[model samples]
Target: MKKGTLYLIAILWAVIVILPFLWALRISLIPTYTTFVSFFPKSLSELSLVNYEYLLFKTKFPRWMINSVLVSGGATFLNVLACSMLGYVLARKRLPGSNVIFTLVLALLMVPYHILVIALYLGLSKVKLTNTLFGVILPLSANPFGVFLMRQYITMIPREYEEAALVDGCSRIGALFKIVLPQALPAVGILTVTMFMETWNNFILPLVMLTKDSMKTVTVGIADLAFQTLNTNWGVLMAGSLLGAVPTVLVFVLFNRYFLRGLTLHGGLK
Candidate 1:
């Protein structure tokens, strides 16, 4: 490709990736009632802080955000920890039904979560755990994708490390903490980012699992705002959407290097 063509392609890609965000930012800056009147504000003078102020003062946005951070962070930590342990065991330890278990794990990944959500909902409801954080966290703690990611990555780790740790008088648990986990941080970072993003944006799970306003996360809160206003305030909605999306974007921005490196770090140890 020619240099000019390459530059054009780069520009096109940048525009494709950034245009939606730019539009959101532009709308976020526009005054509420007039913001819907024109794509570009009628004049430079029409912009207002109303969206931000309204979001802060009128909505449960801050509370929703706090709930989001807690839910996403807690879910991410538990899911990653459980997945890591399960992955490590499945990769390194040979049990009687290991092959059968592995096969089932892969097959379950083929199954749609929505199809299973109903049954899980009923079960949780029966246990009186529905409409709660534990309701959200328990079901997600054993994520199939996380299990597979950890399994594949763990297989890349060498047996030598575990052997060495054993020789150093470390128990299996100690070796996992000291030797295996440190090396797995890149994978952990990737998992954390993935889990956080998913939980942060999770609409259905939270909708089904949490009823209280205080327990609702950002996505659902924003959705409720955008639900059935007689006159939809596109500007305010866009602003809320942008705010809802910011944390995931920030996580990706800060740890994206880790995520990319994690993509290549598989199969290193084995």
Candidate 2:
């Protein structure tokens, strides 16, 4: 293709990718009738902040947003810590049954979470974790995929690093905290963003676990607004949805380099 043609194709691709989101932004700023109207507004003469104001003021959006932030943040933190440590074991120490344990961890990647939901509910009920924030956060934090990803990254590192640290009088914990953890920064950053978004976007788990409105995340809160908001308040709901997606997108944009680095390096090695 000609260079002009290639440029044209790229521009068209960009437009196609961005069109839906732009339409959504327009709809969010427009009135709710636009939801069913099948067309953009006739009166571009005036735009209103009515929906934004309603979404922000009249709803429990702030509380739900805070709830999502806490759960996702906490879960991502826990996941990074746990996954990195477990990954160190899977990568370095080759004990008996270690392969089986690692294989089982990888096997969990194939297990549909929905299949485990009922069992998790029963287990949590035994521990009185039902209808709580911890209920929402716990299931998302124990990330097998993060462990796998980190293990791949760790296996690429030279064994000399760990051994040298050990020779310098560092215990396993100290070596991990001082050496391996620093080396796993790229994987940690990727896991942080991915796990945070997973927990933030997850509604089914929270819906199953939390019966109370006060513990809802943004996803569950949006569903509530969709059903209970008299149907015409979709503009308000869209505004909330747009706002809810911002943090995840922002974090990804900022930390995307780390995600790319980890995956690329891991893939290059094995």
Candidate 1 per-residue lDDT over residues 1-270, each given as its tens digit: 899999999999998999888887788877665534556667777777788888878888888898888888888889988988888889899988987877877887777687788888889999998667778878877777788888888889898989998998999888887888788876787787777777777778888877888788888888887884698777777788898888988988898886565445422321
What is the lDDT of every predicted structure here? 0.80, 0.81
The true-versus-predicted C-alpha distance at residue 168 of model 2, in Å, is 2.6
Kindly give the number of clashing pairs for every candidate.
6, 0
Q: Candidate 2 versus the native: TM-score?
A: 0.87
**Residue 24 lDDT in model 2?**
65
lDDT of 2: 0.81
TM-score for all predictions?
A: 0.88, 0.87
Note each model's CA RMSD in angstroms: 3.4, 3.2
Model 2 per-residue lDDT tens digits across residues 21-140: 776677778755443654455676656788888887888888889999998988888888888888889999988888998898878877768789999999998899987888767878
Model 2, runs deviating above 4 Å: 1-9, 31-45, 259-270
